[model samples]
Target chain A: RMDQGEKKLSSVDRTPLHTEYVKSKLNLEGKDEVRKLKLFMKYIGVYGADARISGFSGYICELLIINMGDFHRTIEAFAAMRGKLVIGDPENTESFDSPAIVIDPTDKTRNAAAAISVENLSRMKLCSRLYLNGKMPEYVQSNGQRKDAKDRGTNLRVFRIKKPDIMDDILYPQVMRFKNAIWEIMERNDLRPVSWEVCVKDHIDVIIESENKAVPALKIHQGPPVDEPSSLDFYNKWINMKISRGPYILGDRIYVDLIRQQKSIGDVVREGLKKVNIGKNIDDQKEAMEIFDPYDTGKDSCALDLFLSKFIFRAHPPEKTSRNTRSS
Target chain B: RMDQGEKKLSSVDRTPLHTEYVKSKLNLEGKDEVRKLKLFMKYIGVYGADARISGFSGYICELLIINMGDFHRTIEAFAAMRGKLVIGDPENTESFDSPAIVIDPTDKTRNAAAAISVENLSRMKLCSRLYLNGKMPEYVQSNGQRKDAKDRGTNLRVFRIKKPDIMDDILYPQVMRFKNAIWEIMERNDLRPVSWEVCVKDHIDVIIESENKAVPALKIHQGPPVDEPSSLDFYNKWINMKISRGPYILGDRIYVDLIRQQKSIGDVVREGLKKVNIGKNIDDQKEAMEIFDPYDTGKDSCALDLFLSKFIFRAHPPEKTSRNTRSS
Candidate 1:
């Protein structure tokens, strides 16, 4: 029996405790059936609550199977999910708001599927529908067989950062935070980051794909309207300044063309990283971070594979692969 | 004397009739002062109701002087004018909506300031305020002394089209219509047009200044969201199509990067002109249009001067001339 007035357990601590509670609740016949479904979720890459995976956890899959009866019914239930997916009793599930909600049977206050991101939930539904349609092998078999980085028509920048001596749960979220900060830096500099991915192995590898490698040297700075009181201040500020063009009126607004200090994506990222908060742990080891154009550096095979599978070939199925390769 | 129940006179025919009406209304003493102000208006390049000028006509200037007493008070009245300048009795002026409204003295139904564009009205007010502060010579003397096209940090495209055999009023609007069409073309193709001017001499000279001479070869084309029913259609469409990158999902929306057919501004303009309505008169003579980069062709001195003075030096006063030239 559990202590009545014990403090709430942390997610890491609660997992083992919840497994015991879930095992106690299930009968012998249902236990074997739920175990098979948990393994099935793992096989399809949706069996972790880790920040990197952001999919269904093993315990959540157990709860889903216990409630829905079997693997086929569970897949059918997910395929039919339109908006928010609610499991467990209606009263307990009402408080949780996420892409998928599975009220923890062991601890009613917590959501078992809290870690599932919208993309992952949508991917789960899509995969379930594909599985029902007999197209599962296209997704499962084509995991790491994506085309090379050079084959894709985009400029890729890869950063290899020294991974801090931290646990996987703690390290993964911080790496994701750093990735977001870098994405913002690229966008702020007008580099136009299209897609990005993070792979943590021996080191944290951040791969970003952008539309352009360099921005125009000249940047247009918009100012106040010509009739506004502040327009005089705008004129005074830029009139004597060393600008490329303008302090000229376009329509009603005053604008000046000023020279950008950092034109190349490499230079912009280097300068921008100094100001933005890229997580406390990562910031400490930022000096050890090395930037490379994918062409310059022989990228780690795993990092390249992760980028291609997650981003490049994500929307493509095997039937379309032949056509995509031909056009590309 | 005016005939009753006659058809409405054309602007050209009405000008002489209005001039006679104004002269008869004004006493001999007021006539000399009004005529002097009319000459002043002409000297400052604001004494025409022609489509090219879009400013107060001679008769309008005569009306202003007769109503406001003299040039100094007329300048004072304009300088103090705020939004929607009303120059006649409130009842008749109430019906006309323009930047400036002056109910015609002879024909109460007509707005005498109908031809004056918002820019010209604002220019007249700005000039008046400058004059009030003893800065008239800066505007009057700096007519044709602007710097060369090469010195300015912008890409200039000059088009010398064969001048159509039409009336000045008819031809000027058509030229302006063609200029607008070209501006739209440049904008649609992502060539940012900073400023443009049209000058009609022996040929119709259209000078356009854009941010870049050429756009990137690749262009991003956005499609419907990934969750929408049309996303499958987006996938089907781009899967077979030749594209640079994507049909990839960024955030929620699907996007594809396609190779631009015309990367150069000149090529874009050339192709775009074929599809647009650039006035019936000019369209007939479109084959005679010759494109040039101002550097390749020795630009007409008057056309170059007009581009600089009207666009470049229009915002700058004499005191800032040395500063502007130094920075450039």
Candidate 2:
């Protein structure tokens, strides 16, 4: 009944038989991991989380637990393996592009681990290594420490967004696109942030941390090479540039350092956001959006929590305020 | 007293005496046409209409009239020149890269036309050719008959910016930067405009005309090629892509038809503006910024006027709307 394509066809036809046979074989060897493997897979991720997410499947999780024993050893094996993780020696290895590849224990010809995502794999590795060392990193939406980004000398910009009415599979790409849009905006304005991350729950929170709350007054500009036809247009544009200094020639390229009017990161983001496609769902509730910083914005604890747990560690950065080193 | 470098040193040491001699010589030839030349230069631009604009200076303009004989003929000569216009050749042409090069009439060694900008040359050729052919374009800001842009089935977005309290020398570049920033925004949003123009006046108006008012529901997305390590990420991201079709492979490239959440151009701009550095002066009066279509926006004839004289010429586009034959 759950028909979509060839994958669904196989699942409907052979999945039940494979499940019964694999379980009985595991029972004979007293190697079935109903309790342990299920818990491990859940902790790492919802096995093959979405139909579109080609991460770890329950069958792969079961096979891994049987073969590698417990959670600790199974994850350790995955981490230690370099490059493509080819499991069974099948005759034809035409190759695949999934993050991790594992052969089916019951069906020698199939790849059981074809759906695992690289992002999920990266998460699993980071979490496993930390957990094994007796420390657990905060997962998304999990409450953790609350450190103000400003106190750490980092420029923090929190955008309170309304999550789109979409599932994680679709929402993941949309949110990623939104992040790219913000990142591009930040870079374009020369308020290039050192780091950024997104968190989604009841609502979406975008956290951007830059070295400076405001960029330097001067904007270093580049134009066409000395020879091109448009290089003259560049010269014309800059010679009549509306700034404090320059339209000066810097070697073969035209370079200028003009004063920027909107130097603050908050101001830039506030204004620049009106220029790009920020996804439709967020666009609908765009008016309801809230932008926050540490100094004056009526403090929200959720934003603070996200900054503390996700962005920074309690270990203080050497300096309280990062210098705008990019002012060259 | 003013000291910058070589250009200044030359201007101070030798330029004044040359200016005096040229005026006297032109007078002897019954051609002390300073008044005539000044008006012509201002009309054609490059007569210091903009502080930073390095076009034909008054001295260069005078030299041109004396050599080419009056306004009409001077423009004709400029229009006929091939690649790099070589004026009366100096003894040794070491070759400088400024737009039009002319051997200084006063000091045979110096290139008098070095200050002449390409933008001016381009304007000169365009205006001169058009004039000779019995026409004159509404250069920069001139009152001309207005025509509607929408009847042709094109997308026009207007941004009315409050002019910054800066001189033209400084203002020209800033507005250009603003235009470029908006262009990047439009492209990123997939509302890639076919043509974009900026008009600077008491208020700066940016006009962007795209073939699309709204994009298709799907976005034909591309990512890293297969066999590369990052290709796995491309696969993982799209395989579970939400609310769309495909993570299909075209040769070695990964492709997806993502359902665009924000399909409308207006919505994207409204939302995207919040994420960038919209410059200082613009940010201050950003709330006052208005975006609208033809029938809706309260009659500000200036915007409509620019769209007409500057963009459309009442000439039919033979094939109305260009369908996205690019759907290949």
Candidate 3:
């Protein structure tokens, strides 16, 4: 039957097949955008699993994912809307010069799905496909084209170390010092290490060029804290130094607020705490706050929480609390 | 401060960390024992996944999980073991010329970890500390000579169709016939058409090379059913035969068992199925078995289940199911 209603193919064919081409009659241009994106993704990496977002804002159109072994390969498709070469024309293919960053995707410790965010997707662009031989797949032809087999491998070198010498000398040196400081602060608070060696050093090139001077961007830090060992490490460090005379466990309200403010990396520390662990914990030690109830020692609860609520948590005392105090 | 009580170093020293000294401490000779073995599955010029097993006898280890991404970048330590290398002396650090396969020391996927039985570790012999780039690390440098850059990239290659003449003359012609037979069967059942263009095709190499004449292999299938009026036109013709039905859907359990018995490549079929529109729907087909409560549909369900399970889930079958009940 030449079916138009639902148009679903009702039977399987009995012939030897080579490969299935997606059936499309929409004149090549008009097709389901997601399906087109998927087919393109499959061609680029041969499989797709974790692509998300309705659309993207920058040069990127979508982010696709594939899980191989031990690592998650993320292909950030650049703005297909712009310089995308018309499909089927090998001569017209846009050169994907931007680098693709492969991430751990999910911090196993965190309960989060192994997904990439739109903001991080914007930070990346699909450069070129990396081959196992450390060369780009498209550039290598059997015709003995390039003199050297330099571009044969497909592992995209995401972060190019711009000043390799400078980085080997000054930049990495600074990063090491900063990392040490952060670790020291976390240690005092009895928190676990927040950094993985992979995340800390993958792309020295992109990070060095950006104004966001931190090692990993704040977006990496802005996710849920419960499963984030690194964030918890940082959080514990802040609590020990800033809030005096209490153990530093954050309450549910504070925890929820921190989650809501995930888009802002700075807010986690600024709004969520009373004292900052900017300087050395020992030499710069100064009393951050006086104990709220003199009779109560800080041991009963988290000292950091006590301090954050008093000095950082409240701008104006809750009106209900004030009224209760007045009645008392 | 050689404190003999476990002699812990409380502070890190400023002494330059020598690669030579670090190399000595690594005990490279015994470390290969720590890496594990896995299978590399490739299709459509890309890698699918790695499966680690106990000699294909099908005694699946408990911790087998999928390595999520970057198929080529995986550590090959636990691959088939190589003869022990002469370590400690860099000049004499010779090893048997072998494939680069290893058990990952840190596998994030629970599957790989579980499949790794300690018994398998018994087969491993240690080797030198090669860098992730595949070069011998600095610690193993002989006479201060660094490992070559070309030696650093991991070695794995996806095979390309080197001779199209072989496909044209011998392979694709046979494949086309089998696909037709399968499609006819599927059409008789009102099953959807699997793509002849992309659906799985049996490999000529495996078919000709194996000593046994009945060994079954996998090939690619076209993607799923379409909804547009134009798409249905082509889809109906594609699934017009019984052989095409093999790619579209698996018939009950007995059929799958029969396939498994002949050492048929079920994983290859699943991989092909993943591309079709109905591929994702394969999971739902199990529920359809609920209709045959009194019917001898056990055979049918077994085939469907066998087809549905990927490598990770295939090892252990439920006790109620008989191997004979399933069809391939």
Candidate 4:
């Protein structure tokens, strides 16, 4: 049933023969240690193979527990790890490249931690270190209370697009691609998006906090090098054209100050969306996209939680003011 | 008379002993070929050893005329040359490094074209090519007429400073250094300077035309990478600080949007002058510096001439409208 394409696997597929194969391969004969560790991984939000989670699946947790011997050792291993981390047979490990790599015990060709993203892997290391250092509560315990978005006084642009009827596997990646497209557009226009987050549920919500909402009226436009044949073309094009300053040489190149066509960030994004390759499903529904200020829009609790937990709160370790006070 | 540093050289310094030595070494047996070439070089503004000129000295022209056999051949050689051009004995040419090199016939230790700048060398090449191609009159002839400063409609900033009682060699370099310092200041404050010129006679005039007279209010400030130990310090510093947008993550690094202190080009230049090394003499009289719009200031004919001859007109070859018409 599992081998048949589009056929949903039921309890009939889970035979004693398959269970025995998994038990023998992972060396999990009588112990419930891996099961308890999987529960803890689930609690910490690093327990899914889905695109949205990009974390440890149940099988990966089982493999890690068996490889490391216990939960404490696994946490310690992750906390100590830096850069790329690879586990399993040397030959199998060489084949996989990611922030965290765990080769499958049963299948040497498959990477067990393939779903884990660099950001999620980084988060795991951070959280492990925090738990070990006795500062886990500040991060792990989500109280669901955060400072008002307006109180932060940040230049937040919240974009809401109607969610396309697609599977979670397909939809989340498209949402991320669309978010990155918007980021590229913002960067190209010099809007300077500092931080951004994407939350997908009933509607796809993208929150981008930028340096400025508008670009300056005049922008420097660099031309070809003076020695190049095309420099004459550049000179002729801008000489009669309306410019703020140049048609002037700086070093070996020519430059001009042309009046910027699109000044506002909103206009840049709206105009740029048509040019960039935003995932096809999202692109089809881009016409109905609504841009709003953080305060103006009806706030999504999930988006606010993600902004706080993933970005704002997790950006730094708790300040050592208490330690300073004790020492004083 | 020439041996005494304070005493100016006269005809007494030009004794038969020195004349015989020059004529013998340069192979000038009563021929006026080098003299005629020197006069032509002077006409095209490439015949001076002063810092203001930075062109071929009279002696360098004579050496070149002897080395290349005539003025036409010398111009042809310069037109054909690319990158660094070295003339004279292969042994002596290795010691001197410049855009154009001519080893002294009498003194192999000294470079004859040492004062010739990269710009002057480029001008020589351009003028030579134009002269050869029969486009000499367009560049070489000075009719003492140009468009009015107001008619061009460029953002021209003219600054006049009282000239210190100093030699031409000392004053010109200092004036150039001051102009470069102002250019650096403008660039640092995000005011894009396109072209600049300095004219020092009774008064030192520095003109810089820029992309804008002011910078934007908000500017992006990059911080430490997230993995680095200083990132926490960066986060703490900007968390409560008055900023426009961030203290947020981009890739592995952190960034913020801070308010720009100095906006106007004048304020940036004035404040920056105190910090930079704009030559000692100019720095002493920086307080007396007067910045003005091109329309507001009384236009100097010499400055206007230079603006037209070197930068404005010489920036590009004349439009090929006639060529297109003939071809059509």
User: How displaced is residue A101 in candidate 4, in Å?
Assistant: 3.5
Ten contiguous residues minimizing lDDT sum, candidate 2 chain A: A312-321
Candidate 3 error regions (>4 Å): A1-282, A286-328, B1-123, B126-328
lDDT of candidate 2 over A229-275, digit per residue (tens):
46546645654435433333333344544555645775676677777
What is the Cα-based lDDT of residue B46 in candidate 1?
64
- The numbered model that scores best in lDDT is 1
Model 4: CAPRI class? incorrect
lDDT of each: 0.68, 0.55, 0.23, 0.64
Per residue, candidate 2 scores C-alpha lDDT tens digits across B133-164 of 56543433322222245443457778766888
How does model 2 fare in lDDT?
0.55
Sort by TM-score, top down from the best: 1, 4, 2, 3
lDDT per residue (tens digit) for residues A28-52 in model 4: 4324667766665655566677877
Candidate 4 residue pairs in backbone clash: none
- Sorted on lDDT, highest at the top, how do the candidates line up? 1, 4, 2, 3
lDDT of 3 by residue, A51-137 (tens): 312122111222122221111222322322122212212322222222122221121111111233322222122212122213223
- In CAPRI terms, model 1 is classed as incorrect
Steric clash pairs (candidate 1)? none
lDDT of 1 by residue, A19-121 (tens): 7877776787677777776665655566678777787877887787778887888888876766666887887888777877888877887778888877667
Shift in Å, residue B224, candidate 4: 3.4
